[model samples]
Target: MNATTVLRAVGGLLALSLSQQLAAQEVPPSLAELSLEALSNTKVTSVSKRSELLTDAAASVYVITSEAIRRSGYATLPEALRLAPNLQVARVDARNYAITARGFNSAFENKLLVLIDGRSVYTPLFSGVFWDAQDVILEDIERVEVISGPGGTLWGANAVNGVINIITKAAGATQGVLAAASVNGDQRVGTIRFGGRIGKGRFRAYTKTLTLDDLQRESGAVSLTGMQRSQVGARADWERPDGASTLQGDAYTGALHQQGTADIKIAGANLLARHTVRISGGTELSAQAYWDFTERNQPNAFIEHLNTVEAQAQAATLLGASHRLVVGAGYRHAFDRLQNGVGFGFLPAKLDMHWGNIFVQNEFDLTPEVRLIGGAKLEHNNYTGWEFLPTLRLAWNPTASSLLWSAASRTVRAPSRIDRDFYSPSNPPLVGGERRYNIAGGPNFQSEVAVVAELGYRLNLLSDFTYSATAFYSIYDRLRTLEPNQAGAGSVFLNRASGRTKGVEMWADWRVTPALRMSAGAVAQQVRTRLDPDSRDASGTTGLATGDPSSYWKLRTAYDIALGHSIDLLVRHYGKLTRPAVPAYTTADVNYLWRIYPNLELSLSGTNLFEARHAEYGGAPNRTLSGRAVGMKLLWQPK
Candidate 1:
């Protein structure tokens, strides 16, 4: 159906749901209320496998609270990621995004790891994320925790550059009804949530759809086609006298039209279960398991089917007063099948792989204010036998509001099917004629590794001002490169290059008054690589594929007045990027909300308000937003 048709259908559902609600109910809490909750309980788990304060966390971690998500009107995870100035997010198409942290940003980038709840979303086929395939009910999200550096020692491979953890709210907290819809020209989005209680437990169910408008090329031709997606998900939480458990699952389907390629269709479903039991004082044990099924089909490109199952167990205990310990182990099995196309395909067509890892971490307190942290992980996989990653950290708290910390860690990016089995090429050249060009995988490829070190300082400079600064340096080895084969017939992937990347970033939060709050951040990074004397990089981007945007900055201002009214403003700027040389650009976005009734809120939001059209990524399709846009949403929460 067309966007308008879907809009009508969703509108009908919204009206039906609203008609059953009370005339007036409690208003949704304001930003201040949400921010206060986050500050008191905004836990960071991805950094150390245990929850801790964001400032006390020994990494460049940032949290995007639910209020931030609501005010941004991003509509998608990729768009919302732009809030973290340390991340590099670029739109490649209406439905595709290139996102990374540190550097090495590309549509097919694989150096970043993403998780939803406790489930890893990175695909085994390419060891990268298909941004389009990742979806969630934004309204159900509690916070997005971002760690902008290596986490291999604790989180495993693919955490080379950064780690993103998308955490959803508990079912009990979302008990109510909600509907949000917005219109930006031809782009439209609608999501409905209904939550209630089952016996003594709580449950929530949600369904959402997205439709995007296509952009026009400079020549008046369409650059990219519009896209559509439908998704449904549900979650339930139960707490007994002895233990607590959660069951959640989701299903999604979507279709997309590429500029020149055959249309693509995707569908997937997953179920996850997590259980926790309190053992003793300050001690807990937990178990988690999940199964995921996904399929992607392109008329002429290729078809991929994947089934994954994972199980893990973890424990956290206070080993005496001065020592705390956290330990965990996990096993993952993936069965994937790929059908070749004229474009790219894996050699085996079908494969089964298993991944296993075990980890242990010890937090030792040298004194009341000095702490030493040490951890290590041992992982085994098909491509890489046994990989050991270790980390060392130290933190010194000299005052109640100041912290100084430093860490050193080792990480690796294990090879995937894409690196060792992929093959494809344009039409072959006539007979022996040098073969126009062939791109094949390297059977001898090895896993890429890096050693990273970081230093950080955080302080509350004033009663209302707080800030954090972190600087990192990393050295990479066995980086991927496109090199000629010994036969000189075609090029193959090889580990023949190395490089160094370093950056410094800072974020500040200020509360000017009881009703006004602002947060600002900026980041700068530089990446450089050198090829071996005998190696030649066909794309030339080998030395710079990290596609460093050089720098970026963002500012967010939120002001709340009497009643439930509030205004949020955001200004974001991106620096120039090389490799294709994209000019710098800036965008301004704002959202205004009015609580017409205690149960209903009306919102007006504008995105890309500073430009007619601006490109964020270079090359194919030249993705961009078309003109300034305005939209509205209805946020209804029944008492």
Candidate 2:
């Protein structure tokens, strides 16, 4: 069915349901009701592996609250991420995104680590996430904590640049029925969920579907085909006075059209279980395990089937009056089978990979106003035998509403299958009297490494305004490069490049009035690299990685017009890219929401209102242009 037809059907169903639930209900408390001081004190766990106030964390972090998600009118996770100034996000197509922090950004960005409820989502093949395959009910997310620096000491390899932790609300807190539908131009989305009690535990199940129309090229011709996806998920939680446990699972499938080619197909499923308990000496212990399966088929390109299993456990305890310690260990195994296409392939066709790591962190109080944090991790992988990651941090609070912090760390991006086993032309055929492949795997590839230092400050003034600023510098070595082989027949992956990066990130929030809030954020950075004297790279040293913007900024405002009405506006500007030469662009978005009834809401939103169409990434003819879009949504949550 077309997007319009599906949208109309879903809209009609929601309207019919809404009519029966017209009674007024009590509105739940929202983030806007919290004072700036209270918001700055939000609890976060990604930085230290333990709950701590956001203002006390020693990392450059940003939290996207649930209320922010609802006010932004973003239907996808990638879109919602644009709110974080520390991140650089670009849409490559209808289903693909290039996201990163500091530097080194690409559709297959390998330096960032992402988690959904503590489950790693990066594929072992390239140590990168397939954004198209990741999704969740936006309304169910408690908060998204984004840390824009190395977290390898705790998260292990691939956390060289940043980490994103998506935390969801417990089923017990979402006990009700929710149905929502949205239509934007030729795109449509629909979701239905139910939550209730099962014995002493709470359970929730949901189904979501989305369809997007084809995108146009600079010439106004269809460049990338449209796509459709469907997903179903469930979660259950049990809590006791001293501990809690959770079990959740998800299954999804999607299809995308390709001009003059067969449709691309994808499907995946995952199951996870987590438990936490209080132990002796006022200690806390937590454990989790998960299994995941994924399948993908791209006609004339390649097909793959992968299975992964992982388990981890951690404990937090107070060693003495001045010291707090956290220790953790994890293990992961992945098995995959690939069917090579004529264009490219991964050698061996089928392979098994293993990874294991153990980490320990200690927080020592130096005085009433100062503290020291240190941690280290020893990780083992199939390709790179063993790698060590370590970090140190110092934080001081001169006043209750102000903080100063500094940190230094060493991290690495371990070799993936692509770095050591990739090959172009699965089976090379004789061409122009040559039977050799164009690209061959690197037999002696090693992990890329980086040493970084950062300084930051945070302040909350008069309980009405809050601001955070961070400055960082990094030196990188053993970076990836494609060097010509001795035989001069093909190129192989190597680590012969070095570079440095320096940047600043800042953001602030202000309550302009009792009903109005304003926020602003910006980031600026520079990257420089050089190749070894003996290195003969086919592409320039900088070509190995994707292009990056030198700077970007965003501004947002939210206003509550009345008891049940609100409006939000956002504006963002991105710096130009140098490699492929994409021009800079600015976009503006606005949303208005009305709570018709206590349990029912209607919203109207417009995206890219300032421009008719623009390009965010990629070069000329093939680059897709995003046009202005408007959407309407209806949500019903029975209390």
Candidate 3:
């Protein structure tokens, strides 16, 4: 169906659902209500790259809302991610982080995909995220949707293990000058935002700045390396009541200046626009487009630039009482410009990708107690001509407050510039050469595919307790692998023959009383790769053994007391590995927040609380000690 048709459908559905909810609220019962529960019903879009309820989705999903962000007292996006067990987020240094899901803990973790709003941040230089480049006014975040398994169908490439979507509130959400600042031993951060309406549209603008001191080495002495950054962003939204349509746009730009062991300076910007139209009867259509640009320069005389442009349009409609059909097509174009001091030739390339797919899912309400879901995506990309992904799901609700679900799906991760045409420097100095060389790319590369099966159960045992558990197994094929060249100058990129990834994730939230709450979550994973006998790199080291490990663990817990105060603890453990170099270690962090008043808040938090004093399992010699620092923050909202 067309966008107009979908809009009419969604218009009807929204009227029905809203009216239903209003009727239910007419006779307000004298029950209990908590501030946190007021907004728990907020809609989320990252689960399937579509809107859905937190309780209705079959996959493992967690949300950290703005209120939660305020209550948790976190200073950055990574800090908030620590609360979710399905994510393994660790700080490698003052400006670097090792974040992944299930396993594969490394400085350049390629398995996970991260997005700010709908703009993908994974770099083309390395198939990983430059965490330091992602900066936002934390308080302005509407919600963070974290999905702990492969989301390749909806998100496409690099979403092999998980997807993290950071959604910010529309311009209308903030209508006044809001300011927050924090200061710690080695860190200082500030945020200021102002928003209002213009005629029929709402607009919000914000600016953020941060300065952090370098982390101390394992030797327990103060380090002189530090980082400084500044950022500015703006968002605007317009809703036309006549046709029930919404128009939204956002722009963000930031620059970083750092004096670390390796001096570096970088700047980037992203501009995005989206339009959503509600249809007549439970159908909708949305279109979005974005442009991202990044430029970086290193003191050692290396310079790089990247520009990416993407556009997509999707339509969703109801086939009947039990079926939902969605169709979409997307296009992406990326240009890379690199200037390297190393002996490799200066290579500049452009990559173009186009994908089209249609998915049909059935939410069959069988016998009023059971439901069945079946869907598929027929996708075509430039690298991989055509790909098919199918999913089957069954959900049984034996009781009103509990659900049991099982699902199986096939997903694919398409090739990217980083996988097919990347050239960069490697740390380990060549055994015989003064400077090491590292370049990876493959024109004959193929897309990575996976067959995933999952079993999950969720229960609201009591009004005070809710728990969820999920087990997943994924069979992988054509996985990306890096091999050194026999010429001894760079690395070769190719797909592995076969592999397997399995894991379990569990989480729970309990309200000891109306004023006291506790939450805990954990995830454990095992990954194995079956390499081809002929798979060898220039160094003659098997890529399979140096990749993600066979075991990994992540755990998180938080306690919120009745007196408008809370405390949280997080721990992550990476299992032992022999191929990748480095030993296993557990990193822990602690945070506390105090709500001084309804409009004022204060907090003090410390990460790397355990001070593991170790390095990541990846290839690097930097002694990463847990950052031990205390910080205080203040926030005010004028009514």
Candidate 4:
């Protein structure tokens, strides 16, 4: 359908507080003030692998609350990430995104790590996320914790750039029926959730679906981007005096349009269980385990099936009341199988791989106002053996509302299946020559490594105004490159590239009144890369840099008129991209919501308001600029 035709059929559509100190209050607070109260009180779990105040986090971090998600009318995780202005998020297609931290944004960027609860979403097949498959019910999300710098020491490999931790609400918190539905020019989405008591534990279940139309081609024709997905999940949690346990799982199926047909099909399911023990002497222990199964089929292209299982445990304890020690270890095994096409295939059609890692971190109290944190992680995998990541952080609190911190870390991005044993027939062999072209995997490809240093400042300008700024520098080595084989016969993946990236991010939040809040963020980075000298390799190797934007700035304003009614607006601008040259663009997103009844809500939201459409990345088969969009939503819940 055309743009006018689609809009005629339906219309659409559719912030966070970080607080420093939360003193106890005698009486209860109102719903409207809960966010502000929690912003100052919300403890974050991603920064240090332990619960700590948001203002005390040594890294450049931000949190997106569920209320913010509902107010902004964000239907997807990627769209929700836009609230964190520090991230470089670009729409590649109707269902694809190029997301990264600092720089180095690409279709398969490996420097960033993403997780849901504690499950890694980065695929081992390509070391990148399949955004289409990383779906979750937006309404069930409790918060998203984002760190803009290295987290390898606490997380693991592929955390060289940043880390995103998606945390869901406890089953007990979602104790009623909740449903939401929305429609726009390009898509329709619906979600339903129910929660209640089951035996001695709380249980919840949710189902969601989305149907998307083809992205509008620059030619005004519909591109082959239509897609559909259905997902369902459930969770159960139990608590006692000394312990708590949780079990959750999800399954989903999806289809994507391709070559005039919705031939790409995908399905997956996963189950996880975790238990926490509140030990005496100010100590805590936790254990978790999970298994995942997935499959994908594309007629004539390739077929893939993967199964993975993993387990981990962590313990945190006090050391003489002056030091805090935390330690953890984990193991993972993946059974990966795939059938290759002419141009695509895994060398060993079916293979099994293992990964194991251990990490330890400690926080030392140098004095009443100063703290020093040090940690290290040792990871081993089939592809890269014995990767060591280490980090050190120092923080000083000069006053009750001011913090000074600096950190240094080392991280790595291990090689993936595609980097090894990837064979593609170049062309028809010479009339009488035996297969003139050969490009294969190297038996000795090394992992990519990076060293990063960062310094940041945080303070409360006034009782209601908070500001933060962070500066970081990173050095990379042993990056991926194409190396010629003996006698210039063919090429293999090698490590012969080096680069550097430096950037700064700053943002501020101001609560002008009880119902009005404004926030703004700005980030800038420059990347320089070159091939290592004295190496026999192809000329002009691809550096670690991809289509990275050099500068970004955004502003967000939110105003709430009633308990569940608000108006929000966001304006953003990104610097021009390189190496295919997507022009810089500016856009605004607006949302308005009204609680028509005690348990019913209606919302109107618009995105990409400046022009008909704008391109953020380049060179994808079905690539299309996302046009201006407006949609509406209805949310209902039992009182």
For candidate 3, what is the TM-score? 0.83
* Local distance difference test, each candidate: 0.83, 0.89, 0.68, 0.83
Better of 2 and 3 by TM-score: 2
> Each prediction's TM-score against the native?
0.92, 0.95, 0.83, 0.92
Candidate 1 TM-score versus the reference: 0.92
Question: Against the true structure, whose lDDT is highest?
Answer: 2
What lDDT tens digits, residue by residue, belong to model 2 across residues 547-574? Answer: 7888999999998887667899989998
Cα lDDT for residue 375, model 4? 97
- What is candidate 4's lDDT per residue for 1-639, written digit by digit as tens? 999877755533110110111122121222235445357567899987778888888889988888778778778888899988789899877887889888878878788999999898888877889898888888788999989999999888999899989999889989899999998668799999999999999999999999888786655667676789999999999988888999999999999887654469999999999999988897889999999998988766678899999999999888887899999999999999988776656777888988899999999999999999999999999987899999999999999888999999999998888787566552425645554336766668888899999999998764477888999999999888877765446677788888899989999888778778888999989988778894566634454274577899999988877555689998999988776577899999898987655566788999899988888776433357888999999998866
**What are the runs in model 2 whose C-alpha is more than 4 Å off?**
1-25, 430-435, 544-546
Assess candidate 1 and give its lDDT. 0.83
Top-down lDDT ranking:
2, 4, 1, 3
Q: Scored by Cα lDDT, where does model 2 land?
A: 0.89
Expressed as tens digits, the lDDT of each residue in 332-398 for candidate 1 is 9999998878766787888998889999999999998989999999999998789988999999998
Off by over 4 Å in 1: 1-29, 33-41, 425-437, 461-463, 620-626
> lDDT at 316 for candidate 2?
92
Q: What lDDT tens digits, residue by residue, belong to model 3 across residues 1-639?
A: 999999999878865765564554432211112433333345777654457666667777777766567655678777788767677765666667878876656777777889987888888556688887787788788888888877766777567778899887777778888889998666789888888887788888878888877766555654444677788878778876423333343333334444343657778878888888877887788888888888877655567778888888887777777666666777777776766655342333334445555544455666577877776666676666878777788888879778888888887777766666555652335567543447656677888777889999877654667777899998888866677665566677787467777878888776666545566776667777667777763342334334544455555555654345577665667655555555777766666765544455668877556553565533444444554566788887654
Pitting candidate 1 against candidate 2, the one with the higher lDDT is: 2
**Looking at candidate 4, what is the lDDT of residue 128?**
86
Q: How accurate is candidate 3 locally (lDDT)?
A: 0.68
